[model samples]
Target: MRMGKGKTKLMAAGMSLTVFAGLLAGCSGSNKEESSSSPKTSAASPSASGSSAASEQPSKIDTSKKVDLQFYMLGDAPKDLPLIQEEINKMALEDLNATVTFNFTTWTDWSQKYKLLLSSGQPIDLIFTADWTDYQSYAKKGAFLPLDELLPQAAPKLYEFVPKDMWDAVKIDQKIYTVPATWKEYVTEGIAYREDLRKKYNLPKPESIETLEQYLDGIRKNEPDLLPLADNQGYHTESIRQLTTKTVNSSNKVPYGLNIMYDAPRDVTSYWGSPQHLADLKMYKRWADKGYWPKNVLNIKDSGHDVFASGKAAALLGSENPNRFNDSVIKIKSLHPDWELGYFPYPNAKGFAQPVHPIHNGFAIPRSSKNPERALAFYEKLVTDKRYNWLTQYGIEGKNFEVEDGKYYKMIGDAQSNGFPREGMQGWAWRNPEFMLFEKSFDAVLQMFSDFDKIAKPDIFQGFPEDWTPYQAEKAAVEQVEKQYLYPLNVGLIDDVEGGLKLFMEKAKQAGLDKIQEEYKKQWIKYLDDSGIQ
Candidate 1:
């Protein structure tokens, strides 16, 4: 019931990054502190058999011992970070008898900084982690501590509140290394159109690919100034890929050479040469010829939805989350009250959207932490306790927000930007929607969860933690090959589609596409067999 509350609209900015954000949501939580909370008493210690007897025991925090925990997060330290940190520490002192410091890796080169942070093994108690943030890789490399034994003692409420399947998702080889943030979302590509434009032109509702084409054609013929569809940094291609191909379960990180078909045979195959890819390319090429999009779409550096928001375009394609609204769309609606936004949740008739991965973002203690017991105890309260969760997510009540009719409303002024407080990081970890304030799209977001539930399919390959170590060399070469060859082909920048595909295939072969396919096929088959999918 609280799942869709106060969700922020996510943008599909860069192609690879956008998809990854949707697939793997957790980033890092930051700072430096001693590992002071693990139980030194024999009564609280985990058994050598690794049984969860600790969960059955009364898992109470030691009130006598005080501790300090350092937390690291993904974004740059905000301007109001210190002010929020002060309030956070005050709450910690009262509730958990601990003080915490927070640090950040700026957005400029976040991935590299995140990698370095984990690989360097600094004294971090809790760090923000998610599938996208290389949580699996770090966990596998012994950078993170296995958390199965600690959860019951440190976070009993969370251990019970989080579903078993979700916990199963955070596991690598039957051991959980991270706590997953609970949220309800459906990651799918949808078509968004200016409702006023559709009404004016008497365009058909954008319910399917064919109707979407009709809508685009109507705009192309009627709207001289606006494009039928817009592309910023090749987003349409990515959106179309989700629509056309069934994503291979373990193919989130790898960009090329995995052949995955949705209609079964669950074996790996070359997506580049898949019939779906070819059909998508051809459809896009036709749209380009009809002037539905700009001729040089690949070079357009402006954000697609931004252009759509400015009323320069009639339609745009990007990722859609039912439980959230696009921030750009919200801002546009705010400025132009007459321009309403309408969404068609799927482009293809299949209506098959990827369910929101259960573990989008959450806190994790590193192997270097000395006080994981205290760290998780603090996190437990962060999610389960109302006052603590509000402070952690929205910041000081009087200063940052106020409750009216049991709903959070940000105080006007600097704190009221984009439905989030300027004083703190938007709730990133252990996010409890039950404590959240609703946005304008709150009703629609909840409706999306219902709609997607009926139409969406659980990814058959959801739990396989992809290990890319063996194919690193091949992956790197293929990435380069894609940049040089596939980019132009997919975006309609190339004149001869056949010639371009031939050259792309040739380069892919040289870059070890065949080997990549075999590896993917072998692993995929094993996973299918293990899962009893056949």
Candidate 2:
């Protein structure tokens, strides 16, 4: 989903947790390596013909008995919520013979807080990490201990539960470090518009970018006063980035994937970086100039849910998962009771990129966990152990939620429960799946995966290490300049092309594009040696 050091080898076959074991177990093989930017794969196997002391046995916790783990949560909640506080603690203590105390933080400041926590050498046991969140950065700092050393002792069931290879994918520097949440594939944002608006405009669902332009234009023609494409306060910049760059070109097979994670300084990444960039800048400026979207777009400070829900916006940008959600459908229904909004997208329009399952948020245990055995046992029970994973994952039965006529319904939160988010129950936790127990009311969302697979691509990218992040900084600087200056100039805000570009490049060079690139190539090569990539 993001960029990396180089090309990656796709897994030989789609694997289950068991099948992935062999790959992860012997991951430290001396085989000639590939790109320093290569993603970790399950290449190791389980202990083969091996015998060791019973203390080396990973399953049994040294139950001199009572244990407690300080779990640091990255997102917000009351210090407690949903009546599970006492219940979860009681269960952990009773079942695993362990107790967990949580420290709460908000998502807005989670990154800084987490970084400070880990770097401060705080004794945090386990945490929830995500690719799109903090996993890569922390792994690079060597913050979390390698699972190769800890798992066998602390997480035997987890070792067995997730198979070795999937865990291998979480490795960095040949050491298993992070565990990804198992999620159904097909996660990426795309165009979502009101079909009723399309009908009002006599437009067809867009199948290609070419058609998207036509559709946007059609919306404008039909509703001249309406900013045909309205972005939530949050999506304006994101929308701009997505439409202008090849960031969404998931077909690339380079180990770095789409390069969306860290936008390279060179405009095309491999091509003339600034030319087509200026072209796109002008293109959007044309939209702004022509008034296709709101002029106050840059000032939005909240979720686009309102614009999307208010019947004011014609289209909203979101991932396939969100679009298929029941809550989204419900929100659309309530906002414009008669409106029929539906998703209009192609997972891979050119149809070549591998349909790598998009994993956003998930969990990981820190090496600092004093009771690795109990920690992983807790994780295993949280995931595979239905009852425990359920309470920790959802909530205590019946109070915050309930099982209605077979479906899990909410009597506590809003709609489903009091103040509950009804967009859909099908959230993709790193470990949680929308099983029958969880998917009761969200039947339509279940088909979202199968429907997407028919269209998902085969070319995929791999995850890369952290040292490269700084190297990519120069390109990022250039992109920022491009976004700030070149784009606006192209829109005729400044008007001179060659002249404007020259000044922009000059200012950018002074801002250190060349030095940044030089540093990137130099450091990237060193990282190659460190990672043992050929």
Candidate 3:
């Protein structure tokens, strides 16, 4: 699976989302107090007796009266989403007697728009949330309802659907506020190269960073118009940062500007100031000068895929989400059938810092939801029921997709042409064990995973969620300072790598990078003791 700016949690290794003030239900002014306390009719409603018995009773589920739930999700609203929603609603009416209204935060300014939508206190029953989408931050601020009691009661099926350990992973301060989607996910940072281009020009398949470099060098020598690689802004610089530092010990914990190194697993420090950062910057400068990437890469909004599809780029550098191979690569092949695509995983030798988890994308009930119980009920069926799953993920089976006896599911007609948008089904945020229908092209994707397994390193700190409350302010300030210089340095737009890095370090220190590091280290020590990670 590929992780991009929109899909992945933007890491601080030069790629981070702008921090925005989240809209907590209590802070909506009109519903300020109501936001903090559970609503009267809600599954988790507060009672004077201090008993959650009300929300924990499955008998309370009201299926007679029809209720319409508003679901907000990140990404564009697909053209055929309405058609899919209509079909899903019909099934819901027969089962839960509920309907759903889908709302979207477009890609243009999704991070900002997400904040505004949540902060607006719109009566959203369910919203797509993830570790990358500020789920931890929002939970700390009480933007979502605690689902521990209500889940077991109203959505017993769903409560049983997710494994207990998976449930434990989403807990913040011992309270569950989000439902982590259960996906059989395998993702890693890799390069997607044009296989045809390499063979046509007598180049070897890109198997390592060195091989990749040679391929790019060949392209630079032969293909004058097509860029060896294309980028947009920072372009998952963290992946390259990881590649350059495969030798350096870094933490498995999600990057937040600073963390423990592999060698000193207990110590916390700013990676921006590390030797790896400088090495990457210098190497990128050389690549940029040699015209590996477009000269105006920073200004180019198009993704490497788009650039490749348009015949302007040769390869893409990113975290490939295994699920997206068909949608991304197969679709591209349709346009340029002559071209063959191949993927080269990062740290290609052996092991990854951490495995990609499904919690990166999931669903959460907002505190503002009037029907949290019903929403979970609706969500339960979407994950467990085959009919609902197919509808949610692939739209009307015959219309959006078709399956052959021995072949994997394939998108057909308009759905194949125009992708079923992320918002269309919130498919990524749902449990997809039984729901995940394979694609014909999935063999290649699976092979890449099998190859990755040979060298995949397990991160001991994988499920430990860092509570950012103590260092939120310091981290935000340092992030802003890092943002200003990181982009330019990452893209090789800076004149001097050393000079720019020195200045970046200075500003980061002034912006409280040290304080953030200390807090992170303090928490990490406690986490180590708690998790028994000696």
Candidate 4:
């Protein structure tokens, strides 16, 4: 089974910020209108109970009237979701006089449903959001409400809990729209291969592209029943891109073809037309010929993780998101306890690693929210209150999981058999590192993150908001062209690399690629100028 849909393509980095203007502004704003509309107080304002590190502080904002909130999150709801939701609601009702309905947009149709939920003007109080989910574009389009006026008064603890730089990172034109997750993570791409197979073949550790190729070749020749590289559309291109780029450039999806040279962060170029891309295309063609992956990989609906765990694949290409990777490891161990798995981060090949963008995982209030203040209060509890955080993130302690010495998280039973595992509820939006737990088995994963932190560089392009509104037509046309030509080309399904490149470039130009690039450059230049970055 697939993990959460939040395991997105490896993302960009964060920028440095000096001040917490959003909090200051929210605190200084007039609250007379807000106070007048406050719900009438209940007869009894219950104090929060439990061993929560975040004690309930007396609030100036009234919570007199009861309210119901509709919150949306990605991925399928676990079988024990109702149980978790009931517990969460019980806490909310006692503390904030609110009840939240947890609505999950199952992975298969989450993208379509996420957009529809925002566009349909539903009374949604909070929804999970992130950079990969078009957060900048949606914020600019007025789909999310600016939280500067509500955070200080409604969610004071969260206001202070999230670092200043994070709030600054989520700002759209000087206004914050999302509450970014406080967790630090690296979303770098890597290969998860069968260590047993590698050892059986006596292959070297895959630290470089050449070594990785050798490993794949070994699998192709030795393991006749297993696919050399199991890859699905979601991660195949990204994995290959990481392998090809090395440390040369950092790319983002917002402006499609734009990229920043690592050595020259201010330099932007159309990556699709670059010589490097052509060389990468040739490499993919060679790999395809060697049967590294199935020719119909682009059409395969199964996730690479699924194929690998089913024991039909030798290697899985994916990101290094710890939670997802750990889950995959646990699942595979349950099925094939004797099969050893190994990981090789692609960035290590070039000694380059970048931490995930600050807004990589966050929550935003839709413009159609009926009770924004109450929603923030609930969210504050979810993020800052240890009881709420542990309950939502880890599920019911005895049944779903248990912690060892309050630091190591351990699943109670076979994770695959359990209805809820650690972080199964998509609680990523409110993850607080202070209360986060790690499994002892995750020592290698933690070591990977530690190693990455030593070489991490700041991504200059991430959080540089680009407004594509002016080039909507060009953006739409370019996306259509990419789907038709670039997708197949990236997967090496196109037979003639040179001819495919020529045709793809011709189609892209015809689709107004130049116009999109021009707008991107203009915005980038402006951002550099504003940030005082040369």
Candidate 5:
């Protein structure tokens, strides 16, 4: 299996240095010996993985045994705390009786970082992978180690804890290669419209994309100050999820976005291979031309929640979760008392699709990891322990949060406790959500959460092993084409819609549209062959 040993060494050395520098981050320092409880965060921000994740150090480590694990992650780096993390590290080492440490790296340019890490074949102990984030691509190139070999002892608890079907789904070439995180329910993207606007215009809540177009037309006819619809330019996935799915599966329990993870129409599905792929794109384009959606949505960065929240636009796209449904939409009720949030779950004339998978961006050991046992032991401890999970998920309970009738809530004022930024980090997204312990009371605030332990509908995509998609060149080419023409073409910013479509199709054709379609067909057929049910 070895090839060009000297070349491998040189490449590995280069990768290590590059990874450490690029991913290395400073730590938070504290003078006091903190208590057992975790710290708090100062303000609102997006969640990340490193600091908020679990860390454990045991009391008695066999220092005579030392091993290093290289860790890969997405987003920001952890802020070290000499007093905090050192104590955690010490405890984990003591428990396992082995010294385990990390060589940390993060991604700014994902494609470039992936290229470097996978090709150099670094001795990575753990890496974050996803179907959307080159998980399959890296596996194809031998960047990851098949976990089946290590799970027995190196990760026995994990071997026993993780679900079989879920793990099996991540297998590539007949071996389990990745550990997927389970996603929570109530994560679907739906169209949210202002009820007050509906009533004001004497319009009905949109039930289908056809109805939605009528509603947007109404907005253009009456609501001069507001956009008929609002959407994000760079985010085409949400549009696909909302406008296209639900016609197939109407269960109301599924939680997928559009383009990459929809599960509906019973007989047909796949992020990009769905039957309505062309229809969804064409629908958005039609809305764009009529000024029914945003003028330059395709160019917008984040979804324009702020505009919709402030009542500058009619609707915004998001999930049924608390933040999107209750938090964002309900907050508007206070501002416009008559305002109500309505769902566009089945815009394509059907109903609920399947839920998104438990998940797939998580840590797995590379063969290069000399200390995989220590690393996995550390991973197991972090997921199962109460102290570790609590700190990682909730910050400081009393400070970052406080309990009311045994329900967890983020704390507001009376600030005395050190904020989490001073202790660990924020966002532990890539960790195992199954092992994550949350006070059940939090579910009461959820908008449409089903009994997650018994998800109403199974994912059609769940455990489906997809072939490596070499769509990087296509993605690059599409982004380029969109950059020059998306907003203009969509908004009739161009002279003719038909002409624009022709031009766009011609460009996409050159970018290998047919080839991409053929590639997906090969994989889909292979998937049918392997599953043995078809």
Candidate 6:
């Protein structure tokens, strides 16, 4: 979920990991490349063929020696992870003569631990990698092993399974360092509001900022117990950006304090000084004075989604990723069925959206891996084999979930409450849409995905490799300034919008905003010229 920086961190903290261990039992399996459009049976065996043309190639690599591999992922380990891990280990040991030890860098201090794990040369065989996690920078630093030759030999089926474009997108310095996920998602921001309350109060549909204000006003007037808009330090600015500019960030590498207009991709400037931002700040100040959210919202560490789910808030604003939105809706519906929910994609206000980048989620083998071959081997099974995928992604099938006609998925019994919610194990790293099961009751969410698929455009800066090595000090200083000045203005904590904007811009300049912007423009223009985009 690209819930901006703050919500991403909070959600990361709330996410639970479940260990899934299962070995591909047999050595005989189809070498044919699975059709990307259709779901197929499990390729439950590892074979030495990278493509259909190479099907007759015999296995030459050895797996005679037993080894135990350590796999690191983010988030807290779920209570049932060990159970799933045990099952996965049994299968892994039987097939590859290896077992996996699932390790998690819990969200509280994951960034520090993640950096230390790579820098200290820990023998981590497999770890989750993503665009959001500085995958390109780490790859450039040689923290990961190049997988060009290894994939064809160790994980032949997976090599054939992933498309050529995805492989190309994850390449750093012309070498593949990560196996990007085979799922296409639209992670644009949106609002999820209480439909029942809207009907009760007879509020207008929240299709734009103006309509949304009316909705918030109705809720504030009718519901004293519920905050009209659930917000946190991370989401207020994101919400304003979504409702106002409706522009995607120019580069994830640069601080989000800079803004890039959708029509003018090359022009990057501080959003705090923008006319739209000033108007948004004024509107937010009005909302704040009206008590749309709590006065102490910036200090409220509770997730906005959690606040909405707990019935303390009338609306939740966040990324519209299908899994994230659907999961939240499912949880809230289960808790309070009477509170009908309605979703409005922020892109709807602008009539366009962007699909998530291919490298948004992926897996990489650390340079210090002692069993890179086995790690890829296990990962291959996890992605291509339905048995392994179902076990790892959705837990123990009938016990944790149920499947209808092998397409739709539904949780059973106390699966969610017991801390084994479907797809909670950072499964995005290996998510293959071909084998993914849709939630049974998520018709609205599925429709939203379909709608986005029609309107989503290719992100112009997709796969733009951003190297911040040259401006490390400036980057740190700018970020520190954002935390101090930008965040307060974001939540409308400042009474004078003009004064706050001026002060924030002044502080940002002092912190080297101009220097960083100069470099950002240079790199962005170079990327455009290199890509032959006018």
Best of the candidates, TM-score: 4
Candidate 1 structure, TM-score to reference: 0.75
TM match of model 6 to true structure: 0.84
lDDT at position 475, candidate 2: 54
* lDDT (tens digit, per residue) of candidate 2 on 115-143: 67776766777776656554765777677
TM-score of each: 0.75, 0.69, 0.81, 0.85, 0.65, 0.84
Candidate 2 matches the true fold with a TM-score of 0.69
Tell me how far the alpha carbon of residue 45 in candidate 5 is from the true structure, in angstroms, after superposition.
26
Whole-structure CA lDDT of model 2: 0.50
Which sections of candidate 3 miss by over 4 Å? 1-59, 246-256, 259-264, 305-312, 352-355, 414-416, 419-426, 451-457
User: Which consecutive 10 residues in model 3 have the weakest lDDT in total?
Assistant: 13-22
After superposing candidate 6, which stretches have Cα over 4 Å from the reference?
A: 1-61, 108-113, 250-256, 414-416
Query: Model 5, range 120-217, lDDT digits (tens) per residue?
Result: 76676766665445566567666667767666656555555455555655666767767765333334456778776688778877776567667778
Q: What is the C-alpha lDDT of each candidate?
A: 0.62, 0.50, 0.63, 0.72, 0.48, 0.70
Best by lDDT: 4
Query: Cα RMSD to native, each candidate?
Result: 10.9, 9.1, 11.7, 9.3, 12.9, 8.2
Local accuracy of candidate 6 as per-residue lDDT tens digits, 1-534: 223553343223212110000001112122111212222232222323222222333223578999999999987676679889999889888878999988988765477689899999879999998776888878887899999999999988788766666677678899999998765556676788889989998999887778888999899889887788887774656665766564654123234466765555566677757787788778778888888887787788666766776667888766434556677777776677766888877777766766566567889999999988888988887887666776788888777777766556777754347456777686887765545665655555555656765655456554667777777788878878887887777777899889998998898889888888788778877875665444
TM-score, predicted candidate 5 vs. hidden true structure:
0.65
| Residue pairs with backbone atoms closer than 3 Å in model 6 (clashes) | 21-87, 21-88, 21-89, 22-88, 23-91, 23-92
Q: For residues 1-534, what per-residue lDDT tens digits would candidate 3 score against the true structure? A: 123531222122111111100121111211111222222211121134322111233424878888999988776667788887888888888878899987877655577788876788878899988766778778878889999998877787677656665676667778888887654345545677788889889997766668778999998898897778867776747656544444222222246556454334455566666786788788888888888886677777665555654556787776344444445566675566667777666546435534444356788998789999999988877765667776777667666667645335666643336546322454677744433455556656555554554444434344455677787778778778766887788888888999999998898888887777777678777866665444
